[model samples]
Target: MPPVNASREPMTLPRLTEDPVSPLSPGTHTITVRHGLSRIEQRYHVAGTGPVCIAHPGGPGIGWEYLRMPQLERSLTMVYIEPVGTGASGFLADPRAYTVTTYAHFLRAVIEHLALPDVVLLGHSHGGFVAQRYALDQPERVEALVLYDTSPVTGEEFWSAAVANLERFVQRHVDERPEVARYVAALTTRLDQLTDEGATAVLRTIMPAYVCDYWGREEEFGPARRSLRMYAAPTRGDGQPFDVRDELSAVAAPTLVLVGSDDFICGPHWARMIHQGIPEAQLTVLDETGHLAHLERPEEFRSVMTGFLALEREDAH
Candidate 1:
């Protein structure tokens, strides 16, 4: 799909292969799993080949395509989860049930259904919150953890700091890139009101700020912005805001904290907090990058990931 304006001709997508030796065999797989009393469809795309790595994409409402990592896929079998309410996945009966904990429940089912006694868990952005909760709640299941472009907690402090940083970013670009102010405004607006299609439009416009230099590299990243599919997921919840700062120290799996230095929301501040909280955690701050480090600097991101995974595997022996 190329942008919202483009026609989405109905087309077929791949499904789980028949009579596979292992469920993780390199291809698409869809399984209906239990999350409490709710029967949900957990559809995941499989690619690459190596140790099983369950990659959870963010957006609680956003589509999973943006998190695709052909780079990391080379060394790790990337199982890209198309989370609930997204394409091919079942929707929640109670929209309010779309919290991180609910997501973790479904994620656990996916791992269990795959019969993965231990698997590497990678979560990005909102998905990171889910990963942390999942890893913290069930430490034994996860072999290692990758928390990318996310924060340990998101509450008053997180929002206030992000607003301050985003204001700075807007002011910096106010003179040269006048349109950035508009984009920033759109980004901060009452996003909860936006429909799924409306969310897609807003996300495309604000996609530039997500990178260190989107306009400079528009040719490279423009396609991603245009093609981004978004669903308006329940963001503002009545439940307590995501906070795992205190619980991070108890995390058993070796963790890697990845964040873009210039990321307005999950910048150096939160990344540092996460680093300090997790004992022996490796923190990689990609300078001159924003929210999407993998998109901004694929090679560097991939190198660090592969290196860390290899080291962890070596240490396991």
Candidate 2:
């Protein structure tokens, strides 16, 4: 890994062409980051200006499309990162380099490459883990943090509870919700045998379990099969029992921990754990929301996010 003060060479972004069909025009840029002994390209999309907020999506491998919330563009430039080994990004030679620490390092390289003095990191699910680690590692470079549907740690206790919750959810809705039951069973059975293609398929099948309005708003889930290579990367060792609870206090950035009340995976328990672990982090548990709170409740999520950003700016002066 490069030193904190390592000189970053300028990387040019692709020219943006006007798209009359779309309301927002985002510019795509890619930067090369040296991970362990392998060099990989990290792709990211940039939109809007003012202050920069780098957004990392969950799945560890999922594409950043789901997080391209237009409301955030009104106030801050949202930079959506496509982690290495996924999307147009370069493939990793060593899968072991897919650890959270490596992801944080990749983020730092992106920030440095872009010449961003300070940034606000918005990480969803697994991305939250990366953002937290990044903020802790580079406190001086991170102005604020938004941890959405993520946990401070993913140790045995967390996974045990998550499994228990899934089991209970299954037992309660198995007969009434056949789709949910099938998806849960599939995930439980096929997790070890997941392939790049099968990964996204399984994820889409189980999407309902992660949303609050899955029953009625199932159509809203849409197609999200883009990057699934990173799914296996995490399990390789980078995300095995991922734990960083003891390091939360080292983060100096103003933090917001957002989660859905109905998020069975990283629910209120993880949210409270993060809030209490951080010195003064704010926690918001959105009702009628699930793992995909931003997607499930865009209006409320936007208000909460924009309000926090505004407050952070207000306190700066």
Which candidate's lDDT is highest?
1
Displacement of the residue 126 alpha carbon in candidate 1, Å: 0.7
Task: Please give the lDDT score at residue 90 for candidate 1.
Answer: 88
The segments of candidate 2 whose C-alpha lies over 4 angstroms from its true place after superposition are: 1-25, 189-192, 222-234
Off by over 4 Å in 1: 1-21, 236-239
Model 1 vs truth, CA RMSD: 4.0
The digit string of per-residue lDDT tens for model 2 on 252-310 reads 99999999998888889988999999998999989988777666687899899989988
Instruction: Spell out the clash pairs found in candidate 1.
Output: 59-62
Which lDDT value does model 1 have at 150? 86
Predictions: Cα RMSD each = 4.0, 7.3
Which candidate wins on TM-score?
A: 1
